[model samples]
Target: MSFKVWMMEIRVPYLLLPIILSIVGGALALYHGSFDVVNFFLFMAVLLLLHITVNTLNDYYDHKTGIDFHTKRTMFNGGTGILQKGLLEPQQVYRAAMGCFIIAAVIGAYVVYRVGLILLPLLILGMIFALFYTQIFARNMLGEISAGLGLGVLPIIGAFMVHGLPLTIDCVILSVAAGILTFNLLLLNEFPDVDADVPGGRRNIVISLGTKKAAKLYSLLTFSVYGILLIFTLMGVLPPLCLIGLATLPIAFKAASLSFTEPNVGDSFFQGQKANVQMILVTQLFVAVGIVASLLLI
Candidate 1:
């Protein structure tokens, strides 16, 4: 496969999540006065590889189940359509997914070795989520929670742990906000996939609650992320500078407003998805920036 095909296969645009997630965790560690540049890079490598594994395995399983064949491929929802396009064999994608997981595990093991055994369970859980997310969790109601935990909460905690720091109260609070933000992202994206998901044996939040309620839930959770940040910042649990994350609120409101309307594969819904993505990335990026800026101001 050529470079572009490979990038498409792994959903390269979505890869930004792991990078931002790594920084969130790493910056929190830095704020606590425990940071190693080498370990931070290793943590990012593991996150990037595991994220690629999630993408490839999702495409492989979705293709095998014919979900990709039935769903409308969009910039956000649906798989990459690589398998359906005959660009890559299913087994090839499967192998690539497994390859990335094995490499991530090796690096994670090294992280554990350097950081102490505290990180072992989280590393193992991350591997499990990568391997079984599309096959198991998406079919049950656990998919959104799994995404929030694996992609959201745990990365921040693990990144903090790599600095040999114990779990602090502030870090846990910030991590939950990350998880909720990610939960909203997955919930919003599921709107267009409800029809295909029902027949595909998937029972995610949108499938369980119906799109109307799910969209409401999406909007509620999206704003609640800022609410959490604001409450904690005011309580002095988070740096007051973390309120910079709320700067994305206008974009978030537009995204949430659009979610209430029909969210089919139309231009309006696409804009909503695009806005949601921007909100997720920019909010997390600003939060990390705020934490680091607090350190400098001190």
Candidate 2:
């Protein structure tokens, strides 16, 4: 397969979310005085690989189940568009996904060996989420939960555990922010896929809760995440410097408004959709920056 096509199907840009999450994890570890440069590299390697694995497998399954065929393909919602265009055969994509999964598994084994048995459940949960998310989890509400855990809580916990950091209230609060933001990432992005996904037996929050209700839920959850962060900061659980993350609220507020007023990603509402796509990235990066800054300045 072509490197260009492979990278496109892998959705390299989307992978940045996971990287940001891992950075938050690493930042949390640093806050606890447990950051290790070597462990950080290893943790990132597994995280990046697992993320690519999920993307590849999701593309393969979507194509196999005919979801991609009916999808109104967008840059964000539809499957990578590579399979639908015939750039790569189904078998090729499947094999690529499996190969990446094998590599991730190897690194996961290394992580388990290094971090001890406490991390085994997280590793296993991640594998299940990557492999069966579209087939099984997407149909139920489990999909978003899996995404939140895989993309959020697990990474921070794994990163912290690798450094042998003791869990603390501040750490849990930071990890909760990661989970909430990541959950919203999937929640907003799913709006465009409601039609295609439904036929494929996927019922995301957008479909189950209805667009209007989901929109309200999205707004509430967005504010709730920031509220919790602010509460912790004010209570002295998080460093006072972490209040800088609140600066992301304007962007998030826009995203919430877009979700409420324009829930679709068609040409008419594309700009709103753009805000939806960026909300998680901006919020998570700002939070990670605040956490890391607290590490250095506190």
Candidate 3:
């Protein structure tokens, strides 16, 4: 294959964006005096590799199960790539995924060596959750709960590993905010795949609840994060500036309204997915800013 063809097959550019964001988030954590630059980058690198592996494995499994072939399925924004377009074979994708996972495992092993055996159980749980999420078993109903625990609690554990201490209530609150934002993103992103998934026996949360009910749930969770942040701030568990995440509320509410109003609308899925990605990105930005502001002003 020509270099251009191989490049197209890999979709490396699309994959890099999320890795970049992960690195930026880790950098921000370091800026907030959470850890040294080296440890933060190492953690980010491991996370980025793990995420990519999961994405690739998901595509491989979806193809194997015929879920990628359904007619009504619209690709989730910048989707898992290989299965969405047949640019790569399923076995090839699986092999590539395994390569990424091996890399992640090496990094994770280093972390465990440095941080003690506590990292072992969390890593095992995270890997199990990722493996079962849409593969061997369906945990779609427990999506939010899984996301909260994995993204929120696990990251804090990673952070503590780097810092060599337990996380404070403030750090835990920030981690919860990250988890809620991640969960909401996943929930809304599933909207577009509802039709395709339902026929393919891929009963995701949106399909389980029906789109209308799912939209309501999505909205409730999005707004509830902000509400919880405010409460945390008032209770002195989190810094007041954490409410900076509220700036994204109007956009979220608008997206929620559209999702609710036009549940089966052809374009609603894509629209809602776009809005969810935006919400996730914006929330990350605001969270970083909020942490900085809190450190300086509060």
Among all candidates shown, the one with the greatest TM-score: 1
Cα-based TM-score, every candidate:
0.98, 0.94, 0.84
- Give a tens-digit lDDT track for model 1, residues 179-287: 9988888888889888888888888988878878988888889989999999999999997689899999999999998898786746888888899999999999999
RMSD (Cα, Å) for all candidates, in order, is: 0.9, 1.7, 3.3
Sequence-dependent TM-score of model 1:
0.98
The positional error of residue 211 in candidate 3, measured at the CA in angstroms, is 1.0
lDDT of 3 by residue, 238-292 (tens): 6557678788887787777777755346775567666766766676567667766
Clashes of 2: 0
Order of quality (TM-score)? 1, 2, 3
Task: Mark the 10 consecutive residues where model 2 has the least summed lDDT.
Answer: 262-271
lDDT of 3 at 248: 84
